[model samples]
Target: MTGFCNMVIISLFNWIYILSFFVVYTADAGVQNHHVDKQNNSKRLLMDENYYTIMSRLDNLTKEVEALKKENALLRHSPIAFLAELTKTVSGQNHQIHFDQVKVNIGNAYYPSHGNFIASVNGLYQFSITACSTANHYVVLELTVNTSVVGKVLAGDTGYDECSSKTFLIQLSSGDDVFVQHKSQGDYLLSASAYGFPSFSGVLLRAL
Candidate 1:
């Protein structure tokens, strides 16, 4: 009877120990699985943040590209040159010579009514003037920029019909005015014809 009781007690103790080991193992496995899950979640969050940052940068780049395209389109369509000629004989001192006939007025910068070129943009510009004098008469033509003399041309006083021309380069601001005026005194007749009319021209060389 004592041997049977001892065997029964030993078996009970063994069973209790096995149950405790199984409990410990289950708890440890659960902890390890939780740690793995936490690590995976952190990686997923970091990946999401990186994705958002990349998308924002791409959006800004697209906006900048669109702005550049619009600026290029505006530059391609702008106009900047003119050519004109006098329609009637002009003479005398300090007279603003109105070239009333427009041949190629690009941008409409040159006005035939007032005979002036008004700059629409700030830029480097080139201007030219041509004048023809009647036989035995002389005339002087001046190119003026906003009331300042910038260039001049002299036709003949040498007893024959003669033509003279001058070209000038200047920097102009927006709203500046350029025109031609008679600069000499006395009865000097300036002539115009289909073959050789007094002419004026201007072009914007480069925009600032």
Candidate 2:
């Protein structure tokens, strides 16, 4: 009886040792798995953050490129803007004249008339002229565009003897002549009063 009880106790101790060893090994394996899962989660989060950062930077770069493209398109389409820029560059570089009864004689003897202003260069030109008659006189004015006349204005008749003014616009090419000639003769002067006589002024801008 004593021997059997001792044997039973030894058998129980061996079984307890085996079970404890299995429990310790399982716990260690679980801890390692938990650590690996945590590392994987951290890596995923880092990757997500990096992706978001890159996306934001790409979006900003795209917007910047779009803005630059719009600006370039506007500059390309707006001729006035380009002309303003060009005028700024050449401002104060050339001689400008406000014509009021100013005689422009090309050489010495080619005194064509007192009314015609000739251009030397061939390009698009914008012309503006204003003329007035005073006192007992009639005004007959013609605005010539290239070789064809574009506008004509007449003032003063038998009964209506007062001050009259006319304005006109013309486009010219190179070697084009723009001028005014008096059709009637009387004791009337071109350009009277403090408002000044008939005048012409404008710049040659490129055509559309």
Q: What is the TM-score of each candidate against the true structure?
A: 0.63, 0.41
lDDT of 1 by residue, 1-208 (tens): 9999999999999999999999999999999999999999999999999999999999999999998887676466477999998868866676888888899998989999999999998888999999888877788788899989888888875666888888899999999999988865444646558447889999988776
What candidate 2 gets wrong by more than 4 Å, as runs, is 81-208
Q: Highest lDDT, which number?
A: 1
Candidate 2 per-residue C-alpha lDDT over 89-126 given as tens digits, one digit per residue, 9 for 90 to 100: 11121122223233333222112233345654443555
Winner by TM-score: 1
Q: RMSD, model 1, all Cα superposed?
A: 5.3
**lDDT value for model 2:** 0.50
